[model samples]
Structure formats: structure tokens, C-alpha cells
Target: MSSRAFTAALACALLGLIASVAAAYVHYQLAVAPGYESFCDVNATLSCTQAYQSVYGRLLGVPVSVLGTGYFAGVLGLLLLGRRLDALASYLLVVALVGLAFVIYLAWATIFVLGTLCLLCLATYAAVVGLFFIAGAAASVPMIDLPSRLSRDLRRLSGSPAALVLCVLVIGATATSAAWFPADSTAAVQTPAERASQTAAQVDAEPPLTDDQKAQIRASFDQLPRLIVPADAPGASVVVVKFNDYMCPPCRQTFDLYKPIKAKWAQQAPGKVQFLTRDFPLEGECNASTPTGSHQASCEAAAAVRMARGAGKSDALEDWLFARQTSLTASIVKEGLQEVAGLSDFDARYPQVLALVKSDAALGASLGVSSTPTFFINGARIAGGMAPRIFDYLIEYELSKTAAPVPVQ
Candidate 1:
């Protein structure tokens, strides 16, 4: 390739590499930082946050964007070597083509399956395509000659097995290091409790809502059904409303965390705390607001829970469902309803139960709840799953409002 051509190729590769790195950084932020909105999160349909958090975001336990970052960096390094490393550049073109193929698959998934478009992801895809053309143009030599040229280069470099082995080891080590050290490592290392505490602290720092906002929130709250709290419970001055999906992993985690806390509230403050659970399934089968296939069994489970509630076994069925969240299926849900709640006639009540589930979902939508495990403590909204301590803080804050001020002597 001419010097000018090579320079242009290198420039394109460099630009593409930078974009890949940026996309990877955004993916890392979405994964580790709760409530972190990217500039690319333009709307419900064009949200980078939604696209990166989907099940397809990761491959083999590693984020795909992280892999893209390493791939682009390797391509950039090969491009910088110029025509002297033409054989390696040719090999990298094949690698870039493979990466491009994967990018195409991800693009298809983002559009048709996930029903969202992540601008950052599209930028990475554009980068991969650019790198493919740049590397292909720079390495004009035919693929059939790649092996011979590479072998000749290897022989000329250090005609020794030790040198080749060392080179291979270096490449492997570099790739492994890139895989291990993703962006924002500190965020990954923080415990869930610490992250939750930080999020709650941020929420707490916000100015108290104006009277109009509080009234609006309360009016929204009145649209939902009260959860089945203990009838004889104490002051019950604080209402804790949770918008949750039965199949959501975080919702299960939050439920388990709140178990003991709920128990403590029942023991200490009785009627003071009223915990209401509302359905917000992310499956389109029943929830029109959610994209299809987001949560496969959520709609079914929500309907089953509604039937269980009619059977006066809401808590028992919820406990069983949350415990086996990973294993939930239509059959399991039906079996649990029959066994846990002794609702052998659940099939007959399917229509009624589905209606109730849809009602709860509509209520959640009206409240602008787009995620699971969102909490409203006395009309104060807290989105996302939180640490038990944060829940305690919220409950106490609500309790304080109900406390009678001391009479001035």
C-alpha cells in the first residue's frame, strides 16, 4: 500500500478504535452504576441503558462491549505497524470481519428482539465496519499468501522457537489483561450494600417534594390495591408500596432483604408500616407497556399471584415464587398455586386473575414505573432495589412524620 493509503487506513482504524473504547466505557457504566443515564439514552425506544442491561449485553459472563474494546485496540496496534506487518494486518482483517459478523447479530437483536436501539452500540458497529474496510484495503495481499508471508516474517524476526513462544505469550497476556480490567473497576468491586447506600444517600440528599408533588404522588398511590398486611398491625401510619415483577432477579433480592426488615416492623411498629406489593410485569403478554420477551414468565406468575391472593394466600405464594424465581415456568407456577395455596380451582379463575394482574400493571404504568422493585414510602418514590439499611432509613423517615410533636410547656 502507498504511504498515503496506509495513513488514511490508520486514521480510520484509530477513529474506529476510539469509538469502540467509548462504547465499552458506556457499557461498563450501565452495568455497574445504577441509574446512570448515558447521552445515548434518548428515549424508551432509543435507550443505551436498556440495550446494555438486556440479557444479550453479556457473552460468556463478559460484556460484549468489553470484548469489542480489546478487539479494536488490537486492530489499531496492527494498523500502526504499517506494511511491514502486512501479514498480521491481513489476519486482523479476518478478525475484524468476524467481529463485524457478531456486531450484525447484536444489531439484529437490539432492533428486532430487544426493541431498542443503543446509539453507542451502533457507534461500535460502525467502528468495526470501518476497521474491516481499512484493514482490508491496507492488506491488499491475497489470503492464500497470508500464511507464507507470516511464516517468512516469523523466521526473519527471531528464527527461534523461544522468541515465537514469548511473542505468543505476550499476546495472550495482553488479551487476558484487557478482559480482566474493564472500565471503572472500582465500581465493580464495591459491595451491593455500599452501592445501595450510595444510591439511597443521593436520593436522601434531594430536596423534599413540594406539597403539590406529594399530593400528586398520594393520588397516584390511591389507584392501587392495598397489599395484605397483618390486620392487627400497629399504628400503620407509614405505607410502603412496592412496584415489582415476579420474575425479576433484583425484585427477588429486594424481597429477601426486606423479609427480616418487614418482620421487625411487624414486631416493633405493627400497624405503623403498611407494605403493599403491586405487579409490574415486564412481559408484553399481559403488560402492554413492556416490550415482548423482556420477562418470559412474568405475566403468568403475576396472574398466578393474583389468583393466590383471591385464595387468601398471597404472601405464601409470593414466598414460594421468589424462592424459586430462577426455576419458574407455567407448570411450576400452576403446581405452586395448587400445592402452596391449595388452589386446585385456579384454572377456573384464570380470566378474573389475569384482569386483576393487568389492572395492577396499568396502575404501575400510570405511576410512571418502568422498572421493578421501585418503592414508595408515604408518597416518597425510591426507584430500584435497595439495601436493607436504606429501607430502614426510609421507614424511619416516614415514621418520623407520624410522630406527635412534644407539647410546649
Candidate 2:
């Protein structure tokens, strides 16, 4: 290969190095920091935290960015060797190809399985591709000579004690960094007394019962747990409270099932049908009901909606966040806040609403909620999720019990 190819590969390696370092920062912010928000989380489909928290983010319990940093450093060292390393072109080509393959695999996993995209990961992939194609195009060695050239390169490197030492140093540095790398994605189980409360947990619910199902639910209504909740509209015939985590798939399903029914009540019954929601993120950052980091982006989602309510943008923002629930991250929640609610100060403003979210989860815990999509239909607690028609049924049932309207003086 030409000398220019080595120089180009060196540039690509340097770019990759920068990307790896950035990735390390992202990993640390997500893994350790509580409620840390990055600028890269665009949605449920484009969250850096979600991508890093996934299986592909590490290799055999070691952070992948640490490994990547080592790879780029070794590449830089090899290229710096210049003419001292025999068959340098062949070595560059082989190394670049291997790196490219791994990059492609990560890309596939991130997009296909994880269903998300991270800007940092993309940057690394770009650098690796640049290195691979640049080295391949600039290779002067024929493909037939690759095996013998590789053999000669290895022998030459083995003969040079300094080159061998370089390899060992690169490896040792990588191992040392990996050993010291932070990976505390776990959230606190015992929330601070100030952070937690004895307040009832936002209770969570399921779909329309057939005749038999209706009969069964009604028969058991007398035996079901009574969930006391603050009514949104005093004297309202029916009140429905949903404790939801935006990133929970079942929660999203519950939202989808209830959307139209709630909309219909908003138009028809207005004040009579009161539909309320509470934030109950399964994530550890601001929620106590479940483990920390359980839902990576849920705290942000909760904060966004709560903030949106003040701006009269809750409906739009909530819909947008729920649509992207599975791929949410703090960054993604910030994006939704800006795009859906025109709240550009998401990072700054979200903290103000976090307390409310934590309080809601604390309340849900006291009320015996342990999962997302819990519901309280006028003091009746139902864990898990149910259908939309059930809300209508419950509303009708409550309506039958409501006192007749009192005449205004």
C-alpha cells in the first residue's frame, strides 16, 4: 500500500479514537449519573443511553468503548511504525477489515434488535468504514500475496522488540482502563426519606369483559382492594387514574387502548368523567416502585409531560412520548419536549418536575403498585393492564352511583 493510505488510516483511527472517548463519556453519564441527560437522545428510536445499556454496548462484561479505544490506539501505533514494519500495507488492510466487520455487526444489532440509533456509535462506525475502504483502495499488494505478506509482517514485528513492547503496552493500557471503567447502571433500592413517601402508589388495570368477565369482575368488585386517590374533579361521577411508565410496552399498550375512550369522554361528559394520570416510571432515577435504570428514559418522559401540563401542551407531548416509549432516553425525552411542546429548556426544566414523578411512584408503591399501567377507578385498584371498553363500563357503573346534580343558588 502507498504511504498515503497509512496516513489516511491514521487519520481515521484518530477520528475513531475521539469517538471512542465520547462514547466513554456517554457510557459514564448513563451508567452512573442519576438523571443525567445527554444531547444525543432523540427519541425511543434514537437514544444513546438505550443503545449503551443494551447487550452490544459491552463485550464479556467489559465496556465496548474501552476496547475500541485500545483498537484505535494500536492502529495508530502500527501506522506510526512506517517503513520499519514489513508489509505494512497488508497489516493495515487486515486490521481495517476486521474492525469494519465488527462495526457492521454492531450497526446491525443496534438498529435491528435494539431498534435504536446512537450518534456516537454512528460516528465510530463511520471512522471504521473510512479506515477500511481507504486502506483497501490504497493497497498496492495483490490479493494473492496477502497470506505471505501477513506472515512476513508478523515475523518482522516479532523480530522488533520495540514493536512487540508497543503491542503489550496498548493491551495493558486498555485492560487497566477497562478495569477502572464505571458501569453502575443500577439504581438505589432504598430512596432517601425525603425522596420517598407513604403516599399511595398510583395503582395500575385490563380490557372489556365479556358477559362472563363483566359478571366476574362485578361479583369480585366487593372483594377487590379499595384504592383511595385524590379525585381530580370533586363530585365527578367517574374518576380514572392511570399509573404509567412511558417506556413500558404494556403501558404503551394500555395508553393505546384508552386513547379514544378518553378522548370521547373529554368531548361528551367533560367535567363528569375525570381522567387522571400519574408518573410511575420503572426506572430507578426518580422512581422507587421498581429497580433503578429499569426504564432508561421514563423519568425524563414523566418530567416532560408534567412540564407540558403547565404549558397546556400535555396532550401533544404525552402522545408523542408514548409513541416512542420503547426507545426513550433522557435525550429523547428532551427532544420530544422541544418538538411537541416547544419547551427548549428541557434539561433545565425537567428537574423541577422530577419531584412530582418521584412522589407519584412513591404513592404508587404505598398503594401496592409494583408494575406499570396500574389503575384506580374510583378507589378500586387493578394491577396490570386492561382494555378500553372497561373504562367505559367503569364510568357507567360510577355514574349510576353519583348523587343527582345539586341546583346552583
Candidate 3:
């Protein structure tokens, strides 16, 4: 390609890299700084937050945007240095084509699977398309001594092993740093006093529930199906009910936060906490309240959990499912049931299991649950993800009402 066209390609790739970095920043902000409002979160259907937090947002625990940032950076480097390495430039064109294909798949997922359009994601997609075209143009430039040019470039690169190693190490370090340190470090440096103040502020910000409101919440909890409580749970002084979907990312986060608190309570005040999980699948296949095709595998997953519960393997199955939340599907659910619990009769029991799921979903819908991971503590609603301190406060508050001091854990 001409020098002018090659420079233009490099410029486009640079622009793309900038967009990827911006998306990564937004992702970090959303995760670490709760209630962050993004410019691209125009609505439910066009929310950048939803897209970034969804299952497709990450690949094998690393955020896709972080990977994109490194990818575009590498492409930018290759475009700038391609003049002296024709073979490398040609190979990058192939990489660009592969990247374009992957972006296409992500676009399909965003539209059909996620049912949302993240403007930042779309911007990155545009960059990839532009890079593919630019790379294609560069590759199309005919070379009289293509083979000889590649051979010479390879020999030159091989001869400078130290330089080559340094470059590889630099790229590897950058990618690793991006992945490991994606969140804002400042967010993690809060002092104990600052954290306590924040927790107190959050609790104070919420208006106290009136007696009537508390009674209504208690009645609502009493009406819902009571799933198995922890074997060692204390008496029902603090009944915690959760409406959760297996496919929901926030639900997974909430569960992770709750697990430790539940464990502590089980050790300290067994039988004092009555925790019940109710199915609230987001997919319309079993949950008539939800939009069709959204969270398509959720109903099946919920049924799988019910099957596990029947087989006395609910805890193991729940842990397994939550760990693999991003990849939950009918096949995976079946495999988990078979492998984790040895439920060979899943197919035979599926209909009964589905009935249990429907019952819970119906109960959730009756309680006005329009979203997953909704929580109720001692008949008072504690919606969305919360800090562990908040849960501790609520549990203590309930215990305080009874004239008996909570046993120290």
C-alpha cells in the first residue's frame, strides 16, 4: 500500500484503540463505583452497563474490553512498524480479519442474545471493521519479491532475539496488568472508618419502614414457598427471602456477598436466620412475566436446581451453577446434575422439576418481583446488591427487637 494509505490505516487503528480504552474505563467505573451513570445507558435496551455486566462482557474471567484494548494497541504498533516488515504486516491483516469475525459474533450476541446495544461496544466494532478494511488494502498491494521479503524480515527478527524477547515481554506485561488491575485502585483503599461511615450513610439514607409496611412484608414472606433453610439455622427471628435468577450476574454477586454472612450466622446463631431462595427465572419460557428469549436457559437451570434439591444435593449444585454462571445452558445444567449429584433420571423428573420452578416463579411474580436478586430481611425489602455490613446491621436490628443479645460469632 502507499505510504498515505498505510498511515490512514494506522490512524484508524489508533482511533479504535482509544475507543476500547474508553469502554474499559466505563466498565471499571460501573463495577467499582456503584450508581455510575454512563452516557451510553440511554435506556434498558441501549444500556452500556447491562452489556458490560452481562455474561458476554468477559471471556474466561478477563473483561473483553481489556482484551480489546491490548488487541488494538498491538494492531496500532504493527501498522506503524509494518513498513520495515512486510511479512508481519501481511500476517496482521489475517489477524484483523479474525478480529472482525469475532466482533461480528459479539454484535450478534448483543443484538439477539443480550437484546441490548452498548454504544461503546458498537464504537469498538466500528473500529474493528475500519481496521479490517485498512489491513485488507495494505495486503492487496502487490509485491514482486514477496517470498524473499518475508524471508529477509524473518531472518532479521530471528537475529535480534533480545529485541524480540523484550517486545513480547512488554506486550505480555501490558495485557496481564490490564486484566489484573482493571478496577480503580483508589476504590479499594477505603479506611475502616470511611467504610463504616459509608455503611452508616447508606443505612440512614433509606427511610425506616413503618409498622404497617413491616407487617405487609412479613405477610408476603409468610405466603411464599419456604425452600430448605440451612440445616443449622436458628429460629426465624430474621427470615431472609431472595428472589433470584441463576443466569443473572447481579444475582451471582449478591449470592457471593451473602455466602460469608450466612456461614458466620450458621456458626454463631444457627436457627436465628431463616433464608429461603425462590426461583425467578428471567426467561419467558417458564416465567410468563418476562420477555421471551431473554435469559433463555434460566428456566432450565432453575429446574435443574430443583432436581438437585430433590436428590439432596442442592448445596453442591448451587455452588457449581454459580461458579459457571456465565456459561449456564440446558446442556451444562444437565451435565452438572449428572456429574455433581448423579441424577441420571433428570429427563424423567424434568416435568416435576419444572412444576416446582413455575410455582416459585409465580410466587415471585405475585410479590411484584420484576427483577432478579431482590431480597427481604425480617419482612423488610432490601433490594439489589448490598454491602455485607448492611446485611449484618439488618440481622442485628432484628435480633435487637427481641430482648436477647445476639451471640457473638
Candidate 4:
């Protein structure tokens, strides 16, 4: 084959590889940014948000795409300047084989696990295959020790780089097919019921909480004077202590469910139940539970809540925090605190109050509160912010224990 044709084929492959890198960078940006809409918005079954946030998205500590982008960019650069380097063909040949393996792994994950493929990600997969073909074809041109059976056949195919071009076309076709035609919607869609069933199946796989841990959680709730309840007249057999983050959206929703329960029990059956709110922000600046920062503005929110509690405006502050959660900036939260409860001087005492909030956060972490809206009801954990229905179920379950005493025959 003419050198010009070979060069053109290599350039086409390189173009695809570059496009892949660009797509990967876009994926990274989407993952880190909060306001970005979910890919599922296009179609509920096709949401990239769920796939990107899953454990499968990361490899060790780094993002999978970050590593893929770097690797593909390196391979493309090496192939582009292959003529200058000595023993270029041998090195390129080995790297192509390694690239082939990575492409296979990515394809498997995208197909079987991720369920929905980002169209651009599929383009990157095709680019890997094209790169391997071009590199292999280029390497075979200057053969050193050709095998008797395969060498002669490869010479014809490699001589014109036709085989490599054909391979690129095949990859492009495969990627196009995969992107345009998706699997059945039913096959891909995992409804709430299915997810609940899946969770039930995995429940037995988890290790049970230890006795000492249970006792510690129980002791923490026992210390609170008036634990949080849902209804005005709670049956009063059990006390629930909740550790929550004001800036957390889910935590706010959880409180919305809990507040009514508390009111119902407080009015109907007063001395029976109590509810207390503990500050547990999931931010690295304040909470040491997590090593990395999840929420940047959580520490300030915690402090504002604390100041509200101190000024005898706990209920008002709690309402304010939940209501104006989206605008929980340092200034806004402080201003709200002052406006709602006459707690002035937020700026003058910012440093000391911030430190105290951080200390409280650390203390919550030391007591095994890793996530927001964690709860302990009479020593039993009700983890994850379930909806009002779940709250009702728990209330009934607790009341049943009182009604159905063990028979002593």
C-alpha cells in the first residue's frame, strides 16, 4: 500500500480517538456539578446520573473516565509520532494489545452493568478498536520475524492497510448500531418495587450491627430529655433521637415526615414520647466522619441551627432551616437566624460559633453518625430517609409491641 493511504488511515483513527477524549471530559464535568440535569430526563430509563453516581463509576480512588482519557490520549500521541521513535513498531504493537483489553472491559461494563450507554462513550469504545487496528497494521509493515503460516497472509492484508481500514469501518458500524438501537425498555427499567426487592435480597448479605454499638446508640437517645416524635399523641413506649443535617435536602424531607408525628403524639399522649434533634452535618470542614467534602456550606448551617436552639427558638430555627435550605449561605443563614429569633452578632462571633459547630459535628461522627438523617428509635436504627408511609409503618410496629404482650402460659 502507498505511504499516503497508510497515513490517511492512521489520521482517521486518530480523529475518532480525540473525539473519545472530549466525550470523557464532558462526562466528568456532568458528574461533579450539582445543577446539571439527569440524563434520565431524556428518558427515565436512560439516566446517566444514576450510573455515574454508582460504585461502578470509580476505580479505586480515581474516576474511571479520568484514567481512560489519559490512557487513550497517550496511545493517540504515541501512534501519531511513531515514525520518529526507534523500535516504534514493537512498542506500538504491545500497547495496542493492552488497549484492546481495556476496550473489552469497558464494553462489558457498559453492556451488562451500566444498562444504558452514553452515546459518546460508545464512540470512544469504537475509537479504541480503530486505534488498535491502525497501530497493528503500521507495526506489521516492517515485520522482523514473520511466522510461516500467518506472515504471508498478513503481508497481503497489511501491505495496503485495507484490513485496518475495514476493521475501523466494522467498529464504527457496531458503535452506531449500539447507540441507535437500545434494549427493550422493560428489560432496562428498574422500578421502585424491583429496587425494593433487590434491597431485600441483599439485606442478608449485610453484617448485623454489634451489641456494643446498639447499646451506645440506645444510651445516646436515653440522654435526651424530649426525643423527637411524629404524632401529637405518640404511644410513648419508645423514644427516637435523630441526627440530621439542615442543608441536606433528604434530611429536610425526613423532618417534614417526623414533625407531624411528633405533634400528634405530643398533644394526644404527652409524657409517653420525646424527640431530640442532634446536629450531624456531612461536611469534611465540620464532620470528620467522611474524609472528603460532600457539602461545602453544611458547617455554617449547623452553626445557625445551634444558635437558634441556644436562643430558645429551636422550633422556629428548625422551620427556617428546612424552609430556606436552598439558600443556606453563611450570610443568608445568619440573617435568617437574626430575623427569626433576635440572635444578632453572627459576624462578630462567626469564628467561635463555627468552631463550636465543627466540634459538635465531630462529636456526632465519633458516635457513629456517618450520614444525614440517621435515626435511633428505642435503640433500633431506621436508616435511610424513607417516606411518610414508612414512618406510619414504624409507628404502628412500635405500638403493636405494647398491645401484644408475650403470653406467659
Candidate 5:
């Protein structure tokens, strides 16, 4: 039974490692590659992408999956060295217990706090739990004195130079891997100087658009069907409409990415560029197309913003909510609605407000918007976030065209 269980635990660890890798890769694709869809993003409520996009996906700036990957790999390594080690069962039990702690916390966060589920995460959790039970059941040492046995064996092993070197190597490897893992949502943000340097590197690599290229892009952009128009642009020659979700990571990134572009519009074109936003939260609570909901507060947050429109606090409302994306909850959103809009009639207005979000979502669906941060630049559709250069180029092109009228195709 002991041999069979150890074998099972090894298999579980391998499976867990694969799941961790999948989770890490999913988040990676979402960050650098726009419009990338995951097979596991079932909806807002049951999305792997949502959990990865949330703060819970990373711990202390390192991707949680990286830790998980290391953990499962360590388990396999320990088990492989089992025959050479004394009191292997005790070590396995102790290690399993340590990993179990993370599983419990992450499971709770996924269900209660983030209000989303990741299929790959669930698989990893199962593997961790299985390892705990298998190790405990197959323990050769006195199970009741696991800690004492583990401590004694660890001390014995530490006395050997070979074991000591191996321990140091493993520790160093885990730390170094975590420190160097590439992630967009690290705990420490980039300083302005760092950002500038990165921007300079990208600029040097990406050649500027020539006049002929710009003209071709313009001609093609004009021929694309215009499916959306701004609701509030009075004399604006160009309208930029975005279908955004407050809970989505890319949406927040895109919002920040557009700040400089928005600044350019204000400074150079003034009323020539008009920007608008529409709701397309991935949550099924408001979006019918989503079979399962993620982002529990998304619909409520949308309602709050809709209500804020009456008070002309919509922009402020967006800013406030987006800033708290990491910790947003339905109760928090509702409470904040009262605090910001401070409307006594917020609850009464909620149903209608939510309906407006639904309406916007329906429109987004008709326009083939499959993800958050979808854009419509004067009717030409873009399904995901764009590069900074392209965003600026399109806007500038439209501004240049404002001097003369061209009929819509």
C-alpha cells in the first residue's frame, strides 16, 4: 500500500505541475497577446482568466502558479530521492501539509473573494489535497509524532555535506525562479524612468508609419462597417467607443494605456475626438451570453456607474471603481455607490440601471465583441487592446480627416 500510494502521489504531482504551467501560460498570453481566448474562460463566474487577472493570481509579485509549479516539482524530486533518504514519509507529510495551506487559502479566495473559478486551479487543488492524504496514510514513521520525526531526520540529513549542498541548491533554485518569473502584475510597479526606457526600446524597434502606409490604413479603416456611434458627441468628428469590464485586467491596462492618447485628443483636437464607454462585463448576472458569471460585483458596479451618470459623476465613478479592482465585491460596490453618487434612490434605481448594462451587452454581442476592452473607432471594430502606436495613429488619422467630409461606406 505504501509503494502504491507513493507512486500515486508522484503522478498527482506531475499532473499538478502541468496544471500550474497551463494557468501561468494563460495569464501570460492575456497580457502580451491581445484577443487571446482561453478554452477555460467559460464565463465571468467560471473563468480561469478572471482569477489569473485578479490580485489573487499573484502573491508578493510572483505568479501563484509559479509557486505551485515549484511545489509540485519539489514533491516529485523528494519522492524520487525517497529511497536514499531516512524517514521519507515524515518529510512527505510535512511538505504536503505546507502545500495544503496554500490550496485552502486560494480555494477560499477563488470562491468568496474573487467570485470566479479556474478549472486548472481546481485540478491543482485536488492534487495538493490528494498528496496530503496519500502521504499521511502511507507514513512509515509514527504519524502522531510526524513533526518530531521530520525534525530529527532533517537534522540527521543536514549533518551530511552532500545533503546540505542539495538543500541549499533547492532553496536557491525556488527563490531565483520566483524572483525572475516574467509577469505583468508584479507587486512593485514600474518607475516612470523604467517605463520610459522600455518605451524607448519599443520605439527603436517599431518603425514609424509612412505616409503611404497611413493612407492605406486610413482607406481600409473607412471601409470597415461602423456598428457603434457615441451617444454624447455633439460636433465630434471622431468617436471612440469601448466595451469594457471594470473587473477585467486587460480592460484596466487598456484604460491606463489610453491616458496619453486621451491627453493628446484633449490637447490637439479638443472636441474633434469623442470618447465613450459601454458595459460588457463578463459576468453572467448581467450579460446573458455568459453561461456562468465571474466578477460578482461587475453588474452592481455597472449599475452604480449608470446611476452616477445622472449626477455627471460617471467618469469619477469609473476612476474610483477601477482603482479598487483588486478588492472589489458586490457589497463594496453598492456601498461605494452611496458614498460617491450618494443617491438615496440608488437601490430603487438599481434594476433599471442594470438593465442599461444588459442593453449595452446585447449590443456588444451583436457586434461580435467576444472579450472585454473591445473597441469601435468610428465603426471599425477592434476585438482587443491595440499597441500604443496604433491607438495614436488611428486617432491622429481621424483628426486629420476632420477637415474634410468623407461619406461612410
Candidate 6:
């Protein structure tokens, strides 16, 4: 390629990098915020809020988007500055490809775990894939004389297997440290309060219930907490409070089961049932109860939920978050929430909301609720989940007690 053409190609790559990083920022903001007025909640089923709030959103302790920002910035800088900077092209190509591998992994998670698709996120994915190819093109740039350099490196590899192994290990270690060590992605770096919450949750282990016992308890409750509330109805007679993690897979399933009941009860009793959802994101970003980062983008997703809650759209946002839970990764969940819920501006006022959500998580721990989908029916606790039929049976029993009835002979 001519010098001009090469420079042009490099410019395109740099532009893509910039776009990807910006998209990553949008994704991260939506995934971490708390609310339904997010971009992902555009539709009940096609929500980014759900995907962003998932466990798959995070990698190690950092927001995946934050990592993306750094990675793309590096690539963009390399491309823009490489012609004048020594060894810039070489480093850019190698680092971009390595980063491409990680991005590919996240893309796979988006397709497989978070089932929803974000057009912007897909565009970012395309940019990464495109950059991987651009890196290949960059390798051919004249400044580095890569072919000869690689030949020598390969020759060294051919003769010294131990040296090759050591080189690979060194490269891998460097990449990992670069990704994980920056304060941005590092573990909660835990605050004292968070540390205490983590310690308390760890120490207070609740005993597991038997299957039959679990069934009996689920059967005893009339309705599970649902995210949405009925309009033009009386306040609920039985309030079921739910402490949930957006990224928690089992919680997603349990939420699905309870959703129908919420709809049914609201239709049947019209204001006799209400569901109060509190954030319990497993990511430590804003959640004091999380000991370690398990779910990737959970903190941002939780923030989105908090934001949505503030807007009086908590149920709508929570359901939307869960509905699209499969599409978002932890990185983009917060952004999805922000876009769909239209509460991007409310992010500044959410620290207290986040704290309250975290406190609710701590309360869940205090109440001896370890796993998610923990249902409290008017102060009666039902730990774990239940079968749909069992829930139906329980609801009928509760409804009968309140319903006017004829006496049996």
C-alpha cells in the first residue's frame, strides 16, 4: 500500500477505536445505573438493561467497559502516533490482537448469556473485530520491519523451547497485570463498610432447606413479589419484598416465575399485591454486601435500577432489566438502563439510593437470606425459589381466606 493509503487505513482504525471506546462508556453507564428509563428498556423483551445487569458483564473486578476504554485508547493512540513514534506500530498490533481475543470472549457471552442485542454494542463488537484485521495490516507497516523481526523471534523460538515458554508466560503476565491491576478494574478495593458487610455475609450462613420443606413454604405464600404494580388500585394487602441481583442467573429464572403471579394477582385482586424490589448486585462497585466481584457489570446495572426507582419506574425498570438480562453483559447494563429509562441525568443524585439498596442487601443478610429470589410475604420469609404450580396452589389458599365464601355442611 502507498504511504498515503496506509496512513488513511490507520486513521480509519483509530476512528473505530474512538467509537468503540465511546460506545463502551455508554454501555458501562447504562449497566451500572438503577432504573427502567434506560436505552435497553426500549422494549419489554429487547432491553439492554437486562443484559447489562448480568453476572457476565464484569471481568475480574473492573467494569468491562472501563477496560475497553483503556484498550481502545491504546490502539487509537498507537495508530495515530505510530508513524512518528518509535516501535508504536508493533506494540499496537500485538496489544490490539490480544485485546481482540478478550473482546471476542465478551461478545460470545453477550450472544449466549445475555440474550438481548444492543445495536451500539454490536457496532463496538464489529469495531474490535475490524481492529484485529487492521492490526494485521499494521504489522506490514515498514517502520517496524516486522517480518525480519518475527523471523528472528521465531528462530529463537525454534531452538529454545524453554525461552519461548518463558517469553509467552512473560507476555501473558504483562497483559493480565495491565488489564487487572489498574485501580479502575481492581477488586472493590473495599471500603471499610463494604469489608464489614462482606465479612458478615460470609460468617452468617443459612441452612439449606429440604425440597419438600421448600415446597411447603412456597405453597404457604399466596403471591411472590413482582416488579410491576397495578394502576388505579388499592395498596397491596400482602406486600412481598424481593432483594435481587440483576446479574444473578438463578435470580433471573426466579423473577420469571414470579412475574406471572404478579400479573395474575394484580388482575385478580387489583391492589391487594405489591412487590418491592431492592438491589443486591453481586458486584462490589456500589454494593457493600458483595464480598468479591462475581457478576461483571452488576454494579452499573444496580445503579441503573436505582435510577429507575427514583423516577417511579422501578418495577418497569426491574422487569425490563430482567427481560433483557440475557442480552446485556455487566459492562453495558448500566448504560442500557440509562438510555431506556431516560434517567441519565439522575446519576449524580443516586449515591443515597445506591446506599439504601446496599443496606437492603445487608438487611437480607441480617435476615439470614443468603441466596437471591428471597421472597418475604408480609414479613414471612420464603428462601430460594418454587415451582410455578406450587406458587399457584399457595396463591389460591391465600386468596380463599380473604375471599367471601359459603360455609360447608
**C-alpha RMSD by candidate, in order:** 9.1, 16.9, 11.6, 13.8, 8.4, 17.9
* Model 4, TM vs. native: 0.45
Quick one: how many clashes does candidate 6 have? 57
Q: Is candidate 1 or candidate 2 better by TM-score?
A: 1
Q: Write the per-residue lDDT of candidate 3 for residues 1-409, one digit (tens) a residue.
A: 6677677777777777887888888888766764344667654355676677777887776777888887887777666555566455465667778889989988998888876678888888887787777667667534455667767766776676654665686489567756675543222333335434544554466675656655554455446553432222355677888888877656765565567678877787777777788888877778777764367678888888888887799877876776665456788889989998888777787887788788888777776677777776655554565656556656765675665767422
The local lDDT score (0 to 100) that residue 159 gets in candidate 2 is 81
| Number of backbone clashes in candidate 5 | 5
Ranking by TM-score: 1, 5, 3, 2, 4, 6
**Location of the lowest summed lDDT over 10 successive residues in candidate 5:** 185-194
Q: Number of clashes in every candidate structure? A: 7, 25, 7, 27, 5, 57
Which pairs, if any, clash in model 1? Answer: 233-271, 234-270, 234-271, 234-272, 235-271, 236-271, 236-272
Mind sharing the TM-score for model 3? 0.53
Tens-place lDDT per residue, model 2, 1-409, is: 5567666777888989998988888787766653344567644345676678778889988888888989988888888764554456666778888998899899988876665678888888988898878877776777788788777777767887888889899999999988988864543221222111211111123333578766665667657777688655775777888888787545654565566677776786678888888888867789764553346778888888988888899987876775554356688788888887788887777677798899998988888877667788888998766545565666666665667532211
Candidate 2's displacement at residue 364, Å, is: 1.0
Which stretches in model 6 have alpha-carbon errors above 4 Å? 1-235, 323-331, 403-409
lDDT of 1 by residue, 204-262 (tens): 56565555655554455456554332223355688888888876656765676677678
Q: Best candidate, lDDT-wise?
A: 5
Candidate 5, residues 1-409, lDDT tens digits: the string is 3668878988888989899888877877655543344768654455776677677888998888878877887787678755455467667888889889988999998887766778999999999898889888877666687667667766776677766666676677768867866665322333445444544554467677777877777787778887755468888888999998887756765666676678777887678888899999878888988645566788888888888888988876776676566457877777667777776677688887888899999988988887777889888898777767777788877766666633322
Candidate 4 — which residues are off by over 4 angstroms? Answer: 1-236, 350-359, 399-409
- Report the Cα lDDT for residue 235, model 3: 58
Hey, what RMSD does candidate 5 come out at? 8.4
- Candidate 3: Cα lDDT at 355: 83
Clashes of 3: 7
* Candidate 1 global CA lDDT score: 0.68
Worst 10 residues of 2 by lDDT: 194-203
Quote each prediction's TM-score. 0.60, 0.49, 0.53, 0.45, 0.60, 0.42
The TM-score between candidate 6 and the true structure equals 0.42
lDDT tens digits by residue: candidate 4, 195-293: 334334434454554556445544553464443333232555656667777765456656655565677767754665667676677666776665454
